[model samples]
Target: MTNVLSFEWKKEDYVTISGMIDESSDFSELFKKNHEVLFLDLKNIHRINSSGVRKWVLALDKLKDVEIHYINCSFSVVDQLSMVPEFLNKKCFVESFDARYVCENCNTSQTVTLVVGFDIQAGEKNYTDGPERLCPNCKQKMEFDHNPDSYLFFLSNLSNKKKTAI
Candidate 1:
């Protein structure tokens, strides 16, 4: 588990969370008592455990009325979104997240940023079928690291929220 200092509050309206989200994370203080919208920045988060998932669910339960917008969600966060059905809640929305890719030749992995309503086009959830990226380390074609159907399952819920017409 990473240190509790991974959570940071800013402007009394937004919270930026980094590092691994484990039992050590203090999500209680991160949620404000009075706020219409809370922008959560998960850009730097890399991991979340079962305990962290439980804590995350409980924390969101407390903010039922608050509109939470998730921004810069890493691959770990994406996994949570897929596994934990209530993790995102109805009031929450994902703005952008990271998609993983790897080079078979070099075994190099990279994360590509994908916006909820942009990079993930409607009726085209499989990134593997999309454009191929050049591996930064090996200069070879990089493949999607995880199964598209499983990795992008969370997007199904968001597809109707801010979807861009194709």
Candidate 2:
């Protein structure tokens, strides 16, 4: 069975989405005529299927005029963002997201939160360096679990779009 997606409004401009995004997911309520800015928190999203991706892209297209700030994106959300070009638009900006890190010594894995323009710069083709993450179990530093290039592919795609528009 697919997990039900839920939406909660923390503020007039901020909203949180949790659970799974599938064919049944409905984002109609988020489509507003006068909503100028929106902060979308996707930290708790665990899974997304192809149908969900279609729905998400359509929803984003509707909000093309609104400035969207995506925050607390989970690994699943990040994966989709990297793979799907239509997952994000010119008006959409990623404020923060999580990256998987693993400790070589203890083999303990953890998700590190990275802020855009601070921890990592968007629109850069290469992202070799990231903020140092210390392992909880061991004192040694942890290494990023995924390849920076593939994980940050969306940033490069966004950058290309900006360049072509200029």
Candidate 3:
């Protein structure tokens, strides 16, 4: 199957990426051809493979001047962000992203949108002591799906204050 990357022009200097990224993603051509794009929004991306990861890292390594802004990131994307520190180096920041929780009593799942610098602790990889949600099915307090230290590991490398919507 052909892996396709879709771009939506939000502005002359910004573009939103929606779709899966794989070995076929040629960001060099896209970035080289469109030098005006300084911001990339990865809110709608669904999945990315190892090859995609390698290609993305390589592309970003070349484009150090470009800033990446992650918004509405899916769980898979969050996993990648948390796992690979270079996936979101100092030039990158997350505006909003998805987080998951589970209720042990009912086995129900919940997904929450976490805003950077608000829901997430400043200078840390964990959420703030904000509101807690009850499981819809069992009315029990939900637990975070992943460990904060491990799941939000990407924050250690990210500098969120740069040109972000935060």
Q: Estimate, for each residue in 50-92, the C-alpha lDDT of model 1 and write its tens digit.
A: 9889888988988888888888888789899988898888888
Which is better, 2 or 3, measured by lDDT?
2
Q: Candidate 1, 70: how far from true, in Å? A: 0.9
Off by over 4 Å in 2: 159-166
In angstroms, how far off is 74's CA in candidate 3? Answer: 1.7
Per-residue lDDT over 1-166 for candidate 2, one digit per residue giving the tens place of the 0 to 100 score = 2388888899888899988998999998798546888889999999999999999999999899988888999988999999998999888888889998999899899988897766876777677755688999887999988887788777666542221110
Candidates sorted by TM-score, best first? 2, 1, 3
Q: Which candidate gets the maximum TM-score versus the true structure? A: 2
Worst 10 residues of 2 by lDDT: 157-166
RMSD (CA, Å), candidate 3 to true, equals 3.5
lDDT (CA) per prediction:
0.76, 0.83, 0.71
| Candidate that scores best on lDDT | 2
TM-score of 1: 0.78
Error of 3 at 44 (Å): 2.5
lDDT of model number 3: 0.71
